[model samples]
Target: MTFQSSSKPQAFAPLSAESMAGGVYGWLTPYLIALAKQNAHIHSRLLHLTRTELHFIALCLALMGEKRDDADHFGAFARDYDRLPRRSLLANYIDTAGPGYSPKLATLVSKLAGRPWRMRSYLRLGELYAEPHARKTLCHLASISRWHLIALSRLPAPYRTYGVLRKIRKRYDLACVMFGIEVVRRVRTDMTDRQIIASLERSDTSRIRDWVEAHYERLPFPTAPTGALTDGTGAVSRPVATARDLFRAAREFDNCVDRYLWEALTGRSCFYRCDNGQRRIAVAELKRLPGVGWAVDEIRGPNNAELSGPERAQVFAMFREAGVLPAPQALSRFSWFDLE
Candidate 1:
C-alpha cells in the first residue's frame, strides 16, 4: 500500500483540540525557516562537487536523517572525526568528506547492486562510490561545475524546480522515512547482535542497519520483526500472511485501545517539548545507534514541541496500524512518560 493510503483517511488532526490556535505548527515554523536559510548556506558551499560527490552528499543527508542543516549539530558529528567518541563507530564509515571510498557505501553496493541491465539508482550510485574495479567498464567521464550548473545539467529540459539539486535534496528527505522503516523491519527480524557486530567489524551495511535497529527497538512501543520485508531499490515490498490476517486485525484493535490510554494518561499527542539538554542527549544517543549519524537529525527534525495530544495520538494510531510500532501495551508504565 502507498504510505498515505495505509493510514486512516481522516483529516490530519492536531493532537489537542485546544492547540488548534497555535501549537505544533507554531513551534515548527521558525525552525523550518531556519532550516531553509541553512539549506541555502550549505547548498551554496556544495556547488563545486562532482557527480560522484553529489551522490555521496545525498546519501549522507539521507543517513543523517534530521537537522542535516543545523551547522553546529552537523559540524559536531561530521567535521571532527572524533567529536562524538561514542558515535565514532557509526559516524566514521560515511565520512566521505574526510577522504576516499566510504566503507559503508562499499558494503551497501556489494550487497545490493545488480548486474548492468537491472541496476537501480540507489545501487548504481552505491557502485559509483564503492566499486572501483567496475569503473573501467563504464563509459562516462567525470564532470564538475558550479552547484547550480551541475544541478541544471542533470535535469530534463523543462523542469519545475530550480534544478536537479532540489530533486536530489527531496530524494534525501524521502529516504529518511524509507530507510527508517526499512531499518526497523530489518532490526525486528533479520539481524542479531552478533551479526550486527560482525558487520561493524568489517565496516559494512550492517553498521547502518544495526544502528537503526538498536535505537528503534528502544522506542517505547517496539515492533517485532516479521521476517517478511524484502529489500529493493525504488519501493518497499512485503508479503501479507493470509493465515495470520485475523491476528493482524486484532493487533490493530489493540493499538487503538493503547492509543486512547496513552492520550488519557499523557494528555499530549507528541512528546516534543523536551528541553535542549534533553534533546541533545536524545539525539546523541540515536547518533550512536546506526549508519551515518545525520539521518537522526531529519527523523527527529528541528521542529521541537510537544505534539498536541490528539496529533500524537493520531500518529501513534497511524504507525501502529502500519505496523511500525508494536501493538500498544494496555498498561504501559507512564512514570517514564514524565520525560516530557
Candidate 2:
C-alpha cells in the first residue's frame, strides 16, 4: 500500500505529505487571497461547494480524521480559516441561482459538501461561475462525455480534495485541461504499480467529452451516498466555502496541476489511512520541483444541458469498455451529490 515508482519511479522525483506541506507553505496565503477576490460572489451562489472551501474543510476533516498522518497537524493555524466564515455570509445566496436551479443546486451543494464530489464539481461549479471572460464551464464539461463526468462525480471520500484532483489531472495526457501553464501533482495512494497505470489509462482526456455525454444522469446527486444522507444533518450543513477559499484551492491546484508528472506510484487515490506505513517520496521536496504540466482552456464534461440519459448511458458504457473515465472507482455509484 505504498508508492514504488511505476516504470521510471526513479526517473521522476518523490513527494510525500510532510514534504508537500513545506512545498506549498509560503504560497498558500497569496493564492487563497487572490482566489477569494475572483470568486467572491459566485461561490456564494453555486449549487455545489467551492473547491477551495472543500479543500480547507477536507483539510479540517482530515485533521480531525482518524489517521495521524492525515490529521491537521497544523492545529490552531488550520482552525483559523478566515475563508470559512467569509463564505458563511454568502450561504444566503446559494439559494438564489434562480428557482429550479437553486433548489436542486442547494441539494447538490449540500450533498457535494457532505461527500462524493465535494471537491471536483463544487470547485468546477465555482470556476464556471467565476470566469473573467468565460461562460458555461459546464457547457465545456457537458460536451466532454457523461462517463467522464460520472466517474469524476463518484469519487469516494473522507472528502479528500487533492486526492481527487490528482485522480483527474494525472490521466490521459491531461495537458489540455489547463489554459496555458499549470503545475500538476499526481498523488498515489495504496495503488499498486498496475493500479496506477490502469488509473492513468482509464482517465485519458482524448475521450473525456465522449465520457461526459454518456453518464450525464449518473452524476452523484443528493439522493444517495453510502454514508449519511443529506437530510438536513448538521454534519452535512450548508457551509458556504467562500470564493476566496475556492479560488485559492483552484490556484494551488492550478500550480500543481500544471506540473508535468511523468509517472507517479502511490497508494489507491493517494489517500493513506496508515501514517506509519511506508515512506515514499519527500513530499515537501517534490512540491518544490519545477512542476509545470499542461493547462488547457474550455470546459467539457457535465453541465452540458444538451445530452439525454440514454446518450449519457451509452457513453458511460463506452468509457467502461474503452477505459477512459475520470474515476474508475466511482462505477459503483450513480449520483455525484450523494451524502458524506
TM-score winner: 1
lDDT of 2 by residue, 1-340 (tens): 1122222111112224454333222223222322222343322432344544544443322222222122223222223334455344234223233222211222223223232232234434443334321222223332332233343334322112232234455444243332111111122233354453343345544443332222222222221101211222111111112223222323433323212111111110111000012311111101111133111111112221222444334333432332223232132233242211
* RMSD to truth, every model: 29.2, 32.3
Estimated TM-score for each candidate: 0.18, 0.16
Model 1, residue 65: C-alpha shift (Å):
7.0
Location of the lowest summed lDDT over 10 successive residues in candidate 2 = 267-276
| TM accuracy, model 2 | 0.16
Tell me the tens digit of each residue's lDDT in model 1 across 207-253.
34334433332333212122222222222222222213212322432
Can you tell me which runs of candidate 1 are displaced by over 4 Å? 1-56, 63-123, 138-140, 143-340
Q: Pick the candidate with the highest lDDT.
A: 1
